[model samples]
Target: MARYIDAEKLKCSIDSETDSIFDWDMTIEELYYNLCKLIDDEPTADVQPVKRGTWENTNTPNQLRCSNCEIIHFIAQYPHGEINYCPNCGARMDGVLSE
Candidate 1:
């Protein structure tokens, strides 16, 4: 899964490595690739995982609501079990399977 990393922290890491690891033979491109690898090795908390939500039936027919953010959405029919994500909040709509 792809996730975000702290860009400022990554920049600091690159800056610190630039002076210590560079040599007369090491090209800038090599340094860039090395930094990319280093950043990939480190984990940073820049964003939370995708939020989870469950489908809740609404008063109106063929309408479902997100349990997490309470965003209502219209659908073709009831029993909206196929929907896996909330359009408004980008939450994974799977409380039953997740729990």
Candidate 2:
């Protein structure tokens, strides 16, 4: 599992620190750059495949939904460890479940 910190929360923490230590003098560009750096330095989670099975001949566990194309893919069509991109839309599979 991966841990994620909201960027707004991080900015608030930085703002509090800089205000107390430097009189709130940090530029917006500097803050933005620091936030980007922090995000880039954060560790990425290992890709874990969603659980899959068949129920009454239908795909179960519903695999991962594509965020870009709004498509639900069956896990049986894709080989394990080879589903980094969406076959329908060529989009990156962020592994985020659809609502």
Candidate 3:
């Protein structure tokens, strides 16, 4: 199973301990990855996990995407509300844009 770390939580953690010296140069994703390394935690997902088992099983839409990794997932493979994590890169599948 893929693991997802909340981006907001991670950002708060980083901001509380770090000075402004490195903040200007880093993107959220960069800060997330670096923080994960420092704390030995799972990397942050670009978006929140989709609520699994929430989508109807039949005719589920197949257009969800991972904004960070840019990977598309097959919607039918997951049970509705059961696909919180991305299979490709372990990113949260929530807020996946339709494309």
Candidate 4:
């Protein structure tokens, strides 16, 4: 997630810090930048685009095949809406998939 500075809270905090007896090792702006850098260093995961496919019914009543992988999957029911991904290839079917 991206971080943003809250101007009102920062102003209030700076006002209170002005009354503190602690000696300044760095300028207030420099200290603020350092604190923000620490928060911005948090890890974020990247989502990669994957091959998309829909399930196609097979000869077996409860089995469906993946359009992308052509691997058959067995489920409790046929034409089920709950099956969202191809287990073998991880092709997504829950959202709008590109060719």
Candidate 5:
């Protein structure tokens, strides 16, 4: 299993004691890039995208209902079966996916 840290947590974990280290602030993208480099040093686990669809298909419906925190992940092969989860609040999609 991969361990995913929030952006804020990642920023605080950086070491600033090196001689060449500077205090120049970095944007979220830059921080994320550096964080990825650090995380890449170890055997990284899979970090699922914050969007819908699988790794192969990037064109799937991924909208979620904020009131319930439910998401339509992917339609299952079976008639009514589908893979869904609430990535935002981390809840299960118990309701049927809408078209």
Candidate 6:
């Protein structure tokens, strides 16, 4: 699978093989969920795993993106919010099995 790291400042840490970028308050699960959402909107529907990454902000951002599909999903999952994605196809989880 082709992989690419897109975040500018964050990439530096990865290249250096350091954990500096991981010390932020964000959880791995949250990052994973966000990654799925960002890549969910790709036009190709490739259903392949793609690489997308982001840096931590002092203030938690409003949205997180899927790594593969590039679809925007809400950071806060609330009463009327749903942010889910398919591991196989990177499809947006619209409160359904295959949304």
The numbered model that scores best in lDDT is 1
Cα lDDT, all candidates: 0.76, 0.57, 0.58, 0.65, 0.45, 0.45
Tens digit per residue, CA lDDT, model 3, 46-89: 66654332112223356555555656567667767567776766
Model 5, residue 76: displacement in angstroms?
47
Provide the TM-score for each candidate, comma-separated.
0.46, 0.32, 0.32, 0.42, 0.23, 0.22
Candidate 2 Cα deviation (angstroms), residue 49:
26
Better of 3 and 6 by TM-score: 3
lDDT of 3 at 24: 75
- Report the C-alpha lDDT of model 1 over 8-75, residue by residue, as the tens digit: 78788777877765677899897777777878866766677779888888888768888889888877
Model 3, CA-based lDDT: 0.58
**By TM-score: ranked, best first:** 1, 4, 2, 3, 5, 6
A best-first ranking of the candidates according to their lDDT comes to: 1, 4, 3, 2, 5, 6
lDDT of 4: 0.65
TM-score of 4: 0.42
Candidate 2: regions farther than 4 A off: 1-60, 94-99
Mark the 10 consecutive residues where model 4 has the least summed lDDT: 38-47
Q: Per-residue lDDT of 22-69 in model 4, one digit per residue for the tens?
A: 347778777777556544543343445577888777777767788889
Looking at model 3, which ten-residue stretch has the lowest summed lDDT?
Answer: 51-60
Lowest summed lDDT across 10 adjacent residues in model 1 is found at: 74-83
Candidate 3 Cα outliers beyond 4 Å, as residue runs: 1-61, 94-99
Preferred candidate (lDDT higher): 1 or 4: 1
For candidate 1, the C-alpha RMSD (Å) to the true structure equals: 8.1
Error of 6 at 68 (Å): 33
lDDT of residue 23 for candidate 2:
35
> Could you tell me the lDDT of residue 2 within candidate 2?
56
Q: Residue 68 CA error for candidate 1 (Å)?
A: 1.1
